[model samples]
Target: MRIYELGDGTPEVSVVGAIHGDEPCGERAIERFVDEEPTVERPVKLIVANEEALDAGRRFIDEDLNRAFPGDPDADTHEGRLAHALSREIRGTTVLSLHSTQSYAEPFALVDEVDAVTRSICPHLPIEYLVETGRFSEGRLIEHAHTVEVECGLQGSEEAAANAYWILRAFLSATGVLPAPVAGDTEPPLSLRRRDADEVVVFRLLDQIPKGPAEEYRVFVDNFQRVAPGDRVAAADGEAFSADTEFYPVLLSANGYDDVFGYAADRVGTLA
Candidate 1:
């Protein structure tokens, strides 16, 4: 992990990037922002995690770092040891961990569940959706207190990098590390386009959309769109499966994961 800090005193605000080496958007955003040398109202720690994997140009050297949180210092895997150190770096801080996804080309936020910190920060983000990982939060960084994770956009895309930078700026502004955004602010017009009525639709992950072994796979529905009962969800080797009940697809993508296409989520409510 590589860490950089702006301002003085121990930082209570932190930003982490590049946990998955395959996702360069986060790292790109951090470097771009740091290049500006913007003045900050409070200290903020910015980190580039999984540097080894990044250097290797692989998703991980041993295992997924996001799934190895609060890891053991004595653990065997490279990620396990790195997780332990990374966890310590952001502990007790209001954190934004950046990421990009293949499932969606739009930014969205995720947390273990809605809480005071979430309610306070998420609404200010340039996103239309907020996901509650709930029971699926096992070993994820968001399980740590005061952490918000964002899926910036399609992995490896320049748009994702651009989105990540603005999202970081918005998050820092919301947390008071930077001046609040205002009319005629330096931020581009896209950053000001908050969701409908300034509300973020909330979704709770219910179950994984299982995928069986097949030569090829395909997904039919769009992420965040509701799937009606009996709607065709996906196909494996031309074998199709239909939904038994209504659900909103979250992170649904063909070939995104080996064992699953994505996740089935329910629209719980909206956070204003």
Candidate 2:
């Protein structure tokens, strides 16, 4: 991990990038921030994590770093030690971990729970959807207090990089680390792009669509859409898999992962 402190005093805000090495949008965003050299009102720490995996252009060297949070420093795996180090770095701080997904092309926020902090910070992001992990957040980075994760956009896309950069700037501005725009500024600062209304759709993760013993699989329903009973969600080995209960697909993807098709979620309610 590479740490860049962009002001004096103890850092109260942190932005972590490249938790998954294959997702480089966050890293690109961080690099752009560094290049701009924006003056911050408060101290902030920018971390480029999983450098080894990033160098190799793989997800990770041994394990998924995002899944190995609060890890052991004495562990054998590289990610375990890195996770431990990262946990220490962002202890007691408001953290924003950046990520990209194959299932969604638009940015969205993810949190362990919808608390005061989440409610405040999520609206500052350029996202209309907020997914509360519930039990599914067990080992994620967002499991930690005051930490929020975001899927910026589709992995490796230019749009994803732009989204990540804008979101990071917005997060900093919202958190008061970066100053808001002044009068007569030609372009609108990131803070201005934040959703004015408090209406945000919240989705609670229900279950995962586990991949069974099959040669191939395909997903039909669009993500974030309601999947009614008997609606065909996916297919494996030419056999169709329909929803048995009313649910919404969040990360529904055909070949996104090997162990599961994606996730089934329920629209809990809107957050204001």
Candidate 3:
């Protein structure tokens, strides 16, 4: 983990990046923002996690760091040890952890569950959707209180990097680490802007859309779109599976995960 601190005193606001080495957008955004030497209203810690995996240019050296949170210091895996250390650094802080995804090209936010912090911070973010991970939170960093995880865009894309930077600025602004962004002051890329009279749609993870072993896999539905009962959702080796009930595809994509295509989510409500 590499940490950069701005202003004075122990930071209660933090921005984390590069938790998964395969997603470089977060690291790029953090580095670019630090290069500007922007002044902050309060102390903040910016961290680039999983340096060893990042250096190796792989998803992880031993295991996925995001799934290894509150890790054991004496754990055997590299991610396990790193997770323990990273957890300590961000403990008691309101955090923004950056990430990119293969399932969606648009940015979205995720939290362990919607709360006062979610209501307060998510609206200021440049996103149209907020996900409640619920039981799926497991060992993820968002399982920690007051932490928000963002899927900036398609993994490793330049657009994702740009989105990550702006998202970081928005998070800091919402947390009072930086001043609020003004309209016509600076243009945001990819049509990203703060919520203006728009309510963010909230989705709760209901279950994982499991995938079976197949030589070829294909998805027939667009993510975030509602799937009706008996609609063909995906195919594996020429065999198609249809949904038995209604659902909104969250992170649905072909070849995104080994054991699952993505998640099945329900549109819970809107966060204004």
Candidate 4:
């Protein structure tokens, strides 16, 4: 991991990037932040994780790092060891873990639960949605107290990099690492100025649409849109698959993952 420290006290905030090697947007954002060299009000740590995998240009060296949280230092897999180290790196800090998704082109926040930290900072993010991963939080970094994970945008896209950079800036300001933008400050990309800092559309993950053993598959629903019973969601080979119940698709994609189509979620009302 590459660590960048700004300011002189004990760091209370941390932003982690490149948990998955294929998602380089976050790392780019971190580099951009380093270039700007903003003088922070409080100490902050910016980390670029999974360097080996990143060098290899693959998702992981042995396993998905995001799913190996609180990992074992003596474990066999590279990700397992890395996870343990990362967990230690951000412990007790308000962490913002950056990620880029293949499913959606829009940014969104993800949390293990909605708590005081989430309620305060999530609203400041450049996003319109927040997803709570209950049962799915098992080994995720967000399961740790005060950690927020963001899906910046479509993986490897220029827009994703821009979103990640601005989102991290907003997070720093919200957590007091950097002074909040004042009235005379120049407008940033995707300005949060016009947004209600108290509002966010929330969703709770219900289940994932597994790819099963299909050789060829295609998703037909727009992400964040509702799908009801009998609604065709995908096609595998020559057979069409329809939903059995009503739910909204969060990360809906045709070939986003090797084992899943994306997530099915339920709207849980807005946070204001």
Pick by TM-score: 1 or 4, better one: 1
lDDT of 2 by residue, 110-199 (tens): 999999998888876778889999898876899889988999889999888988988898799889998764678644345334454567
lDDT of 1 by residue, 1-272 (tens): 99999999999999999999999988999999999999999999999999998888889999999899989999999999999999999988999999999999889999998999999999999899999999999988898899999999999998899999999999999999999988977764464356484799999999999999999999999999999999999999999999999999999998889999999999999888
Error of 1 at 96 (Å): 0.2
Candidates in order have lDDT scores of: 0.93, 0.88, 0.93, 0.89
Report the candidate with higher lDDT, 2 versus 3. Answer: 3
Clashes of 2: 0
TM-scores of the models, in the order given: 0.98, 0.94, 0.98, 0.95
Candidate 4 — worst ten consecutive residues by lDDT sum? 188-197
> Which 10-residue window in model 3 sums to the lowest lDDT?
189-198
Q: Model 4 scores what on Cα lDDT? A: 0.89
RMSD per candidate (Å) reads 1.2, 2.3, 1.2, 1.7
- On lDDT, the stronger of 1 and 4 is 1
Off by over 4 Å in 3: 194-197
Q: Per-residue lDDT of 151-225 in model 3, one digit per residue for the tens? A: 999998999999999999989999999988787768577467644537899999999999999999999999889
